[model samples]
Target chain A: MGKLFAVVVTIITVVSTAIFIAHTWWLPPDISAHGHAIDRQLSETMISSGVLFVLSQLALALFAWRFGDREDGRRVKPFPGGATPMVVFAAVLVGAEILTLTLVGAKVWAGVFQTPPDPNSLQIDVQAEQFAFYFRYPGPDGRFGATHPELINEASENFFGLDPARDTSARDDIVVPTLTIPLNRPIALTLRAKDVNHAFYVPELRIQQDFVPGLTIPLHFTATQTGRYEIVCTQLCGLGHYNMRAYIEVLPQAQFDQWLKDKAAQQ
Target chain B: MRVRDLMLVGGVGLGGTAMMIGRAATPPGATISGKVTFTGTPPKMKPIDMAKEPFCARLHAAAPVLTENVTTGPGDALRWVLVYVSAGDQGSAPATETVRLDQKGCQYIPHVLVVQPNQPLDIYNDDSTSHNIHPLAKVNAEWNKSQPIGAPPIHAKWESPEFIPVKCNVHPWMHGWHLVLTTSHYAVTGEDGAFRLQGLPPGKYTITAWQEQFGTQSQDVTVTGSETKSVSFVFKATPY
Candidate 1:
């Protein structure tokens, strides 16, 4: 029985190690700035974690197998009151990993949220409700019009409660169901929630920011690749949570200009 | 090492401004569009409970039908079927173009809408009751917003690829979908399992169809600028 258990644990460890390596090795190379950072950090942490995990598990298994029925009755030895060095070593490993990651994470957060709005940046106003994200570009003036949530009426074609009659600023404002941006330029987004708290998250970009009601949260990032990436809400807001999706197109400069021209024509 | 080091490595690796080249850089792509319908018998339209959303329930009576009425003939077809174009040569950024999805009579209008990334979506709720738009997207931002009648509409955009489902919490059964694509070329098959898309620069294209209940169907076709090609796809019913 003891031998059987040992064999089983050995197989389990081997399989788990193979699985751990397979899962981590198969991911595509990191491309986004933040995504790459987190990916490398996570990969290193995982490699170390995986090694430690296997070592500890194997140690435990070996001890159990060898001692499972030693009916020889050996006296158990108690850990010395202080194994001070061992205790300190274990504590330092855990606390230090957390501290280091936190510090690195804080810096990444700052990069994502603190950089000043550069003139070369593209600006987008994002309004979140229930389960969807509404993005507004100041249109030609770049000055946002006042929007009253209280006045929204979808059937009457008064969505976003632009109050066009009352707020002339919104008259030229363009309403689009999708979002487009120029490639390579830093993009800043201001987020707001009309009713409840909602989170804006995009996995490929490795960014997730929340939309606070009555408060605007700014999130910024520069696209690294031309291909379209996916952005989804992390917070579970409502039933539509499953179907809430918007499109973000990163166009070349010239095409972007044409899009602006085309959109302006609508007004 | 440090975060800056990480970023330096990432920045160098992800350079080129990630700009969107024209559709020319993208291989040729075909469009697919079709209406979803039912044959033989149509299902009975039952009034769904909008108590949670009495405003919507009060204004609309039968559940909105995008799926063909399948009670009398064939089987339950086209009802809540998600049909979309799946494969195509990638396209440029999402146009400033916008699609409006209205919440009326406790249902989402334009039941099936296909959009590319970076485009805007206007969510409007007309009924006096409140309605929420939630998109369950893993690739794009996941958001939930509620609109009360007499309030402003909620506008949002997608920066990535995702298949979003819209629903009204007030009315549990009220459902709809917002399909976001990374590529600009795509189409949703209609009831007759037929789809059409025009405007091509002439090239080889891959067209795919999606059905919420029927899974996915795909095919490849070639089109020249002055040429129109015929494509057909069928999805046999299967229990998912």
Candidate 2:
């Protein structure tokens, strides 16, 4: 029975560890400028924790197999250091690992979140509703019009509640479900929630931020590759949260400019 | 015992024949036709902005789709009003036919659809993009499901009568209504604001007209035989 228990534990530990090592389910390729650093920090944390996990599991199995089913009623012998030194040593080792990771990880985190956005970066306003994401680009005037909640009428496709008839700045505002930006250019997004809480997550870009109702959050990122990626909501906002997703298209500078021009024409 | 059994059998046979004859003697019923009109100020319909969905926007680029909540017709006529026999309905047949609701150009076709209780409703996504159909049904079971492009149509039905408001969360601008009616004698007004409730049995009935934005109006009317009775409803509309 003891041998079987040890074997079961060993198999479970080995299989789970092997899956991680083989990258059976890994993150998508990094396309954001700051994603490489995040990936490196993630790898370091995983390796450190994984090594500790394997060692501890193996040690437990070995001890159980050797002394678990001793039929002889012999008095159990304690460890040489009376368990205090061992407990202290383990605690210190785990604590140091956590402390080191946190210290190293904070730099990568700060780089993406704490740093100021470039002054020339394009600013886009994002409004998340019950289940859809609407991105608004400041038109030629480069000014966003004020929004009135009372004026918001979904039936007329007035998702942003802008009074284009009276507000000149809102007349040219281009709102779309897809977020299109120039590749390698900094992009700052102001996120607002129309109803409940929501989250904006793009795995390829390594960016995830929350959208709190009644508050506007600012997030900045720079995409290095030109491709179409999915932007999914991670928060459990409502019944349609599972279907809440949009597309993010990164284009070259000239193509992005032309796209903006065409969108503005439609507006 | 033998005599009693023979009498029981005779009674059963007579009862069955009489039921058949009674059903055959019923008339084709009366027809109630009406026009729904409004007085006072009506809110102006604004053009829908489908710019979120490029495919839908391009489809309606020439003439953008307008809001339908308060759709008005010529000469104070109101469209999309539901006229039905609210009272004096002599039982209703079980609905078996499937009703279709389509998502095209990022909008719900018909805007307002009427279905009987337990009737099958098939929702199809006709656009290239995905759509999540959520019916905010309070009395009946509320369900939210996604229909992606090329996916099979969703099969659903309501067990109880309710005025369900349906919306596509992916496209917030996509709004619609599902009115589950218990009476088979009902009609929805067309663009001309005309409605006809056919096959109503001869009796006193409370004819009700329901407008989404203007609330409901009811009037009592008596139908005789298979004659056609004319009824009109005038709703007071507000600009706001």
- Fnat per candidate, as a fraction, reads 0.02, 0.57
Task: List the per-model TM-score of the A chain.
Answer: 0.83, 0.92
Looking at model 1 chain B, report the run of 10 residues with the lowest lDDT sum. B1-10
Q: Write the per-residue lDDT of candidate 1 for residues B82-179, one digit (tens) a residue.
A: 43335545354545655556676666654555566767777777666667666667777777776866778787888877777665544444566777
TM-score for all models, in order of appearance: 0.51, 0.65
State which docking tier applies to candidate 2.
acceptable
lDDT of 2 by residue, B76-143 (tens): 88877788888998986686867667788887765777888888888888889889899989999898
Q: Write the per-residue lDDT of candidate 2 for residues A1-267, one digit (tens) a residue.
A: 778888998999999999999999999999998999899999999999999899999988997898778899674786668889889987899899899999999988998899989999899999998888889999999999888877876765567888876788987888877899999999999999999999999999999999998998999999999999999899999877876778899999999999999888867
lDDT agreement of model 2 with the native? 0.82
> Which 10 consecutive positions of candidate 1 chain A have the poorest summed lDDT?
A152-161
Please give the lDDT score at residue A25 for candidate 1: 46
What is the per-candidate TM-score for chain B?
0.69, 0.87
User: Residue B47's C-alpha lDDT in candidate 2?
Assistant: 69
Runs of candidate 1 exceeding 4 Å displacement: A1-10, A24-33, A73-76, A82-93, A156-159, B1-240
